[model samples]
Target: MIPRSISLAIILSILLQCARSSTLDDMTLMLSNMPEDGRLQFPELANKYGYKCDTYNVTTDDRYILTLYNIPGDTRRPVYLQHGFEDSADTFLLRTNTSLVAFLVEHGYDVWLGNMRGNKYSRAHESLLPDDLQFWEFSVHEAGTYDLPAMIDFVLKHTGQKQLQAIGHSEGTTVFFVMGAQRPEYNDKVKLVICLSPVAYLHHSSPPLFPLISLVGGPAASAALSVAAHGDLLKNSSVAVDLIKVACTQKLLSYEVCAEGVFFTAVGRDSEQFEPEFLPIAIGHYPCGSSVKTGAHFLQIAARKKFAQYDYGLAQNKLKYGSLEPPLYDLSKVKMKIALVVGKADTLTAPKDLQLLRKQLPDVVNYHVMDWEKWNHFDMVWGKYMYVFLFNHIHEMLTKYYV
Candidate 1:
């Protein structure tokens, strides 16, 4: 008869093999079923999780077609959530049900997540294909002046709500501030504006990648991206996305390295709270692509330290703004009730920069700093302790101001 110890060892080895095979099979199935365009079908995904999801398309004055994701609730207050740079509605949803959207939906708020032009969901145009150079020529200025207004108009019209809350993250906040200044009338449409990791004065931003971009200079980098993109600055899908989905999710290779790279751009203070498994999924949806001009605009913001229009040469600047230099955004014109939520460890939105912005705004209602010293930029969405530190205050303010 076989030794009992030997028999037990053999059984344990077989069980480990079976478990590994099961994990591999699951990862393979997921890869095959993932969207070809990398657009997360919120409705299908949300329905899988037992929630209702709806979508709408709004055409900007420039004819760029943008998409909006809606998760309806019985509450009367409509809340518009905008994603940051290279991010999508998925950024908020990436944390699963504990995400801000889920929390708001649970608590009875009409949640609408907007995607800017050139993102995965907003790559359509009325007269131009995605490949057209014209489609890739806009900057955040256009997004601020056109996309934000168009989405705002659509949301207010559809819900018949005179005023809704605006919550912006990173570049999301940039657009809101621009719109408020460029089109002051829209100010009345927002009941309150919450700026999360608010980025405007960015001269001091120290994101890991900023140094490389700054060294290249905005114009040179823009030119290089234009050449590489062949006019379609960032496609929704890419080889990198596919590779990560396979490698990290299956844990077949470099999963830890992959996780570190994913968070390197905008890190959280507490690395332990990051969901490694979700890294692959988040990577597939993010870096959704934007105009080369948008990238140049950010580099300009980082170098110049002021919120202004794109920096055309002196001659072009004169033609565009009647001045040799692009005029700074008139923040004093922003009359909305503004609240700034910043992270202590956020290098992307330095506290010093936010302080500068706070002084510029007309009606600054509340300026909140996350309680934790290590709460970095992305932690606002990814932090495990957010329910206690961040979301509670958000809920409180929303309740206090809801009309």
Candidate 2:
């Protein structure tokens, strides 16, 4: 006769195996049934909504080929929209008619969407391929230094305009600050900059997972480095996206559980603003691929609590930055007219950090915090009531400066 404990363990293992099989089956079914619209790229997605979208490839000074998606308008008032970390140009078009891109198009402003290097839309380099380790060895610092200037010059030259308005969300905002500070000459080329959920000094970052991963000598940090050493993380692939959509949207895992684990925990919780129906589409495009180096850079910022260049240890720091510590990006050098936006519930960009940033910035023309209590970081882009809470305010700001 078998012991009760041993028999129970065997039975439990059998049940677990069955559950795993069930989940796999469900995911396969879900992927097979996914709508065709969920697979459309940015250009096709934009065109489907009755917008004439044009694609432009601009090679950065560093030889990184970046893609710019343009929705042409009657006016020469071009507005450049830069996407946040792990996202691509498609981010702006996820909400259809109510999207920020649509809002800009309706207002008759020429819209140019920028895809930072390492993202799926802009992954090519002149000499190195995506598979090469050297090609993925860039952070937001490089994007600001090379990619932004290249794209900005291209946009200005293409539009035959001296200046253009810029809008950046999250890492997008960081790169803009980097460009303005590192390449101060380009500051004159931009008329105004709207920083949404700006991330500069991350001393007070509230995300629970961030601190765990940012710890210098911690296991999480070591694990992150190991993964990053492999090359690109979460590179956009339809199969991978479909699997995520199934896990997040289908009954394999409840949407609330997925959102809480993935979105809410990382940023902030705002259930009312999050639309369940958009989950599949959102999953398909987002986490659009980035180098582990870029993520490591941000993690260093969170860990060190300073907006400084990537730390390459003592010997390497001396060789690269010419100091024991990475030098801070000079905020005072960012002399362009700027507007700052924040969310009350955003954990990633805490209010305290923004307060410090405001003091550092030389000229902040406007500063506005979302009135809604539950407004979080992703809400700036994915919220259902974004038009009411964010877009109108953005429109007003553009009109104030440009119109």
Candidate 3:
């Protein structure tokens, strides 16, 4: 006796209500069961997962104090792992048993994790506090020129190794490439360099936020964010972390929607591979912090579509580099045997940009694209299948190249 349209509408309403109620219940359960240990600092988390972690402070040439984490192994083969943008040494420790650090340690390879300056773990300076504006004046340029060299030297000296194999993910790869191009001497100190989701030529980047900023101009965006955050952006502030936790894990929004909107938009979209349980811990540690200048540099690269030094505008560029524009980092100068692992779905590092990078690098030992179509940018560090898809290849490379 009911009209068909009315009945259909009634059914749809019931289904919608059921879906919302189910989402709320799932969110509640996930929050209650969220692992507290994931929120711990790097060393503590590593220890919780049954791995012995050692912390060392290395001073950069520019006097920035960086924190380095080491997972000791019986062998003299030291492998350095550097994290990506707005991340810390904790990036490698997030996956617990299947983590890259754990895999390397289990294989009897010494692993050292590098935390770049301005991150939560490495914000100390000889004279300036993190609150000081001068302390925030650095970009990836300083990171590559100073942080990488300092950490590399410290690890080599501590292990008494002449050379080490280096693995870098995202911005980590950028810094390594910068070191190789600028301080070519350090290239000899590294036996092999493996780049994961490498980000050097970012003009083809597809991230909406990055490209928007690129359109507005890097300097303007940098200035705006710097002014708003007082030189530090998203550096694991309790307020920001709590808000993110609520947005991503709370019952107000479904976990899938929040994850897709917040994290997946920046990194690639791969819901199946992304561990929902790890979301709380990842939110607590990530967007760990970086200077406005560092972000501006990347935005500049994205806008210009060139792998070059920081752009200080015309006057400053003239004063600094004696030119009206920034100078390009000569990838041809990087003579070390380099291998690249890229995700086909990575939005931040496009295939066209990767081609540009490949065209420039002098010695590319290997170039690999993930077989899985959904493999993404963050998956380099957070993917659940990393051991099966990524680590095995790395192990083979170590066997082939590490001498």
Candidate 4:
């Protein structure tokens, strides 16, 4: 219900720059320049449906911002939604009148959605430059440490409530556990946590991508990306992937394989159906690119089957890459009433991966390795039927667990 005309001129102006020779940094700038009206979708969605939304900076470091959609009803209880990787509050706020978000809005429970750093909406790092991967040093760490806490505190302060219900999907669940484990008091702040497709203690295979990152990626490959120096390489990489996906999709439409490669296998989704929900009109504002040095850090977990720190290119990988270890988090301490929704057919983070997480976390309330039949990593968010089948259980689970 947000007015579409708010500062379209400004958005178009930036879109012009982003479209021409775009880089990671350029994409980062685009979010900051978003029209106030455009940024108010969450709140406006709430308002149009008789709810209110407000977005503000909540990070101690000035980089974390939380967007809250408030709907006041009989229940004083609140629900907070944490988006998955490479997504924003839009994950919960897209053009839909169904799903738990709208339902929660009509029910009068204040529902707030969060955007972690590196993704759009919460990229304001005071000391970090979007042009450099160094600016995104925290990775998922910031999501747990900075973003979650800020969101909780903001919700409590505004709603005048002592506790709230929490829900996370994919990396959203990863961060919930990360935050709860590191800050146990936060466990007290949430009445319950509904985790969708939680991942842990498992090695997933992303077809061609698995080998691609393992053999060609790592710190050294990240260094190679540094030369391109597109701070917004995530967006560019997304573009590259989209371009390739288009070719594959067209071929699929024609009932054939054109080149026969493994690119789609590693990407976590079938190329033919990767059309994201509510594709960002600006596309350039999408900002999840990181150097292989940064990616090299994840290789440790891919190999070790646990969430470990990023390797700082120590003596182990000294020849091709530098030594560095990204921080790690423990997943066991999370006691939230979590729910996991995983696609049966996902290769990126297989359904078995979600099973591993369920085994590790004793407090899980609901667990589903979806019989999606054809679902994959990206299906949980972008699949055309997600709002139909995926979130059907969400309303019942959330209403039952909280308030």
On residues 1-403, what C-alpha lDDT tens digit does candidate 2 reach at each position?
2333443354354345444665666656655544455678999998899999999999988799999989999548999999999998888888899999999999999999999998889989889998887788888899999999999999999999999998999999999899999999999998899999999877877756454544642324533573556658678763454445555545433345556555776798887877666766677677778987787788778787788888777776888888988899999999988999999999999999999999998989999999999999999888888999999999888888883
Which RMSD values do the candidates have, in order? 8.7, 5.8, 6.9, 8.8
TM-scores for the candidates = 0.86, 0.90, 0.89, 0.71
Which digits, one per residue and each the tens of the lDDT, describe model 4 over residues 271-302? Answer: 43444222332122222333333344345466
lDDT of 4 at 306: 66
Model with the higher TM-score, candidate 1 or 3:
3
lDDT (C-alpha, whole model) for all candidates: 0.75, 0.82, 0.82, 0.57
**Candidate closest to the true structure, highest TM-score:** 2
Tell me the TM-score of model 4: 0.71
Q: Indicate the worst ten consecutive residues by lDDT in candidate 3.
A: 1-10
Q: How does candidate 1 score on lDDT?
A: 0.75
Model 4 misplacement above 4 A: 1-52, 61-75, 127-134, 215-299, 315-328
- The Cα error of candidate 3 at residue 334, in Å, is 1.0
Please give, for residues 154-226, the per-residue lDDT of candidate 3 as tens digits. Answer: 9989989889999999999999899999999999999998999998987777756564654545655666666
Error of model 4, residue 387, in angstroms: 4.4
Sort all candidates by TM-score, best to worst: 2, 3, 1, 4
- Give the Å shift of residue 204 in candidate 4: 2.4
